[model samples]
Target: MSAAGPLPLVGRRVLVTGIANEASLALPIAQVLRASGAELVCAGLGPTPYHGALSTAAEQYLGGAREAFESTVREHLGADVPELIADVTLDPSLEDLAETLRLRDLQLDGIVHAVAMDRTIRGGAAKPLLQVTREEFLDCMSASAYSLLALVRVLLRAHVLREGASIVALSYLGAERVMSHPYRNIGVAKAALERLVRELAAELGPTFGMRVNAVRFSPWSRSKAGGAIPGLEEAVAHAASRAPLGNADPASLGCEVVHLLRPGLGVTGEVRHVDGGYHVHG
Candidate 1:
């Protein structure tokens, strides 16, 4: 089919990282963004032909992952939406990704940094900081915290972000608060991330009119990282009860994010909570 003209996100392109499956929050954001007329380009940790982690197992496990995701997204958004691949963890090189998109005539209107990491140190090793390795803790900070800064850096350096661009990163309640031991480094990383979002928003808003923000979600069993958090079920259930509006849907969260990405949305540098009312509860 011939490519259609620009639609809400028309004339705009978005770089969404960390998409895993259809049920993933990123997928829904992609969906809503597409519906709003935005072109799509996805990136992720490797195991896929697109961008992904370099680890053999990650590649093996994530194999065909990007292709499958592209197929699914295209099927839903129609064949016109574009997609791309790149690994965010592979920092310094991330700038090349923007150039890659430029080759396709896609200028970024927004970026979604949904990437995060926790040392799969479950069980005994998942204990308090004393039980965790220095390397593991640093990895968590690098993956979950610095990755956001890295994304903004690459986009800024590449000039891929259009004026008034929106950057959304995910955080959790555990960052400011706490859940348990296994969730340690991630919480610290998130706390750092929340601060980073504000700083970026302050800097970018003045320089480029770009909006930076983080979305804090309650425990949701959609991603592998989330499922690994022990006592997650209880946490989510408690959150649902505390929420004045009851449970929050991933798709709904995506819709809110879509609105934030648009220019003149008048929202930025804020930590938007998609956790129902759980944060308010306690």
Candidate 2:
């Protein structure tokens, strides 16, 4: 046979969420998608201009989140990449995102759900699940997991998703197993996220011919979220040692995302692992 030909993502429009900085997992995924010939839109978390009137330091901190994210996108995907500010847990921002895409005459072929947050996870330590408050737990769930449902709801309402679109969410092994690092609050949220993926896959696949899946990536302790979890670096080193293929890096994660989002894959509701056989150990 001749060459395999052009990249699978040629002409596809993909919305990639969770870019806060260059170190973000979303950045790598976005880059891969773009390289595969997809048009990209990036969404970063917010302390939007409307959050208004802060001290200079606060303004710089918040503004830097957006700036860093956009710069990373531009550096890799070029100046034309759409950049949006969104708080997926908030309906208003989600609506705005849908409107933004409509105004640009874009309909998404795929979405990379990379957003996740947990207030209880700190720099040097994370609060135990026993010590987590009700409000904190709910906040974690809403941001890290339920936001997927909210995003899909709003996007569908706006008809932003194509009839047979695909979706992939980033996840971790902590969703199903206790780990060396403290995964407490967010682990529960991830379990819910995985279930939501299956439910969405089952529901959307039949009615709209869409597919949704989650990827449990190898533990890499360098990204913003990964660095927040105490002992994650140690766990990363440990996992790399035990995993049959060693630690799967962000590029590997990106490659798998491209594979999942490709047209006609027909795989849905699966929590696929990209951790190089670490998941099989247990």
Candidate 3:
């Protein structure tokens, strides 16, 4: 142990998913896990440094773009942490992810599910729920909500998740209630994700000795997804104005993640709030 005491996540290996850019929320969480003494394996939506990990579909999804993803890892996640290319929507891609980790012997102690996407949430105006196509809605749901199940199952079956491991996913206030702007499709998905967190917690906790939880953060506007949302700026301002401690920052969010990932905690099935008391209001 160090001078003070043992670090919270000493000797733990963590996988952090959903880092799309430097602005991504996952960056801060990954940083915190490192600070807490956990080794990290990062998975991003797009390309990886290893060409063997990219399939044809993954290539298409990336739109042949590499610079942006490359920069995110280099600048934020560092050059040492192995950044894997894993798209939860594709089973084969996930298979490859497990294979890659297996070859490298990356048995994880924790996973941060920080990925969410909604194609219907464009910038011009709010796409009405009625106007949203079935394909659009289901795609949104699959990407944002169901991907958690897929990712976790594959990892588990591949022997990636170790015993006594933990999982944490990012969510928002719009998941359970209406907000100032239209969060329609993705909000619905977030509700499903939170529900999955509870269900997974109950089942996985007993069987695998694992814990699962979700954290609902403040109205953040810096992310690619949040910045795309209409009225997000206004919502951020309003939330900060109304919140007792003001809007929470990414550093605080990272701390909460570390708390959840810390071993020996019986905490699970919880929808923890890191929104600076914004959830308390009507």
Q: TM-score of each candidate?
A: 0.86, 0.95, 0.93
Q: After superposition, how far is residue 9 of candidate 2 from its true place, in Å?
A: 1.0
Tens digits of per-residue lDDT for model 1, 174-195 = 8887674357777888999899
For residue 156, give model 3's deviation from the true position in Å: 0.8
Candidates by lDDT, descending order: 2, 3, 1
Candidate 3 Cα lDDT to native: 0.87
lDDT of 3 by residue, 8-52 (tens): 998999999877777888888888788889898988776543445
Model 1, residue 35: C-alpha shift (Å)? 1.8
Misplaced by over 4 Å in model 2 are: 1-3, 49-60
Candidate 1, residue 128: the lDDT equals: 74
TM-score of 1: 0.86
Minimum summed lDDT over a 10-residue window in model 3 is located at 46-55
RMSD of 1: 4.2
lDDT of 2 at 47: 68
Error of 1 at 247 (Å): 1.8
